[model samples]
Target: MIEIHAKTSAANTGSASDRLHTLGLALPDLRGNPYYVHHRTVDSSIYISGQLPYQDGRLLGQGIVGRDVELETARELARHAALNALAAAVQAVGELDRVRIVQMLVFVASTPDFGEQSNVANAASDLLIEVLGENGRHARTAIGVAGLPLNSPVEIQMVCTAV
Candidate 1:
């Protein structure tokens, strides 16, 4: 249950709706208030929950990063996670332009020997830069984990500002 930061008045409504249509994106069916999603107010920001490497509604791969999942595969997983985050952003704000991705937190499920969280997280960060241009640049955190929900390879969460 995400709250609209922008007020109900027409003055607060901007090109967000139009941008959504132009981008051909829509909100997904949310079960409840996402741990990673939030909106303070118009011109405030949108927070998206960390997303896993899920495709076709299921996690693509799992296990230690270097052992079971290859680096390239982990990178791809992060990319998908980033895309999921974009979807969440659009849904939370009703538009993408009213967004300034402030930061990204990436978590990688890996074994003790795997220490490439930055590299893996880059996949998600790079995708955001490509999709949002300069607006995607922001502070980020990449962490290695013992495991993730459903044993996914990568997970990414984002914070975005909107008006």
Candidate 2:
């Protein structure tokens, strides 16, 4: 079995927003999409759709990882996608600190021989814990895909529970 090297947030505390500020980051104020809603809430649970690595409405990186893109680039793209997921979560619940992450699904477009999918996914996991502290720790899955929408390197979908 592969060892889990990602940081755990079990002992973390404090406001998620404050942690975000401390990290020199802010959630992007995203507008609602015309085709589909970014997230939906059923009771206390929020389901966020797959989000690409878009910053200011532009895809961050394209092409399959381990081919045209490097591992570090894919990792950063995952981080950005995770940020988009957090944005959708805030849009659904109206507050960042009011929710706790429950699960995350990370998709990486990579080559057949690329076995570092988990390593690329760690960037997203690390970002969540950094921003949400213990609330951000979650169950997660990393998937290797033949391709992704827009040929982007990474996409992230998430679930959160309002606390």
Candidate 3:
């Protein structure tokens, strides 16, 4: 069984955005431009649009995880989707340090026989924790679905408190 690491109470080393850069990950372009936006703010909260594991107009991997896709590959896709979500949050609030993750909703495309949804979802959860430390700890929901947009293996959405 894959082990899910507990959240760490590490010192605030740097902004979440900087941590992402240190990890050698880049956020994709926002879905909308100057007019429409991929994220929106209401009061002190920011709502990020669901993001797929797509980069440079290409889906990272497709098909059901544990069947057509390997568990590791699907986990990577989840991380990618999380990066997109972080990018949207940054774009909305101008910096990752200004936002505190409140909730995360992860949707996974899986074969009927696949039952390790939490393990797949951990990729995103772990990334956020690694980047934001304590602030990364948030309510999460991992759901297995029959399919996803573009048949991508994972999609992620987030809600944050913009400070």
Candidate 1, residues 62-86, lDDT tens digits: the string is 7779889999999988987877777
The model with the greatest TM-score is: 2
Model 3, residue 28: distance off in Å is 2.7
Candidate achieving higher TM-score, 1 or 3? 3
Residue 57 accuracy (lDDT) in model 2: 84
Report lDDT (CA) for all predictions: 0.70, 0.86, 0.83
Question: Candidate 2 versus the native: TM-score?
Answer: 0.90
Q: Which stretches of candidate 3 lie over 4 Å from their true place?
A: 1-11, 33-36
List of clashing residue pairs for candidate 1: 1-33, 36-48, 36-49, 37-47, 43-163, 46-160
* lDDT per residue (tens digit) for residues 27-121 in model 2: 87666678888998988899999999998888999999999999999999998899889999988788998878999999999999998999999
lDDT of 2 at 144: 93
- Which 10-residue window in model 1 sums to the lowest lDDT? 1-10
Worst 10 residues of 3 by lDDT: 1-10
Residue 56 in candidate 2, Cα distance off native in Å: 1.0
lDDT digits (tens) for residues 1-163 of candidate 3: 1232433533257667677787787777765657556788998889988888878767788899978999999999999999888888888878778767899999999988899889898889888887887778789999999999888889998999876
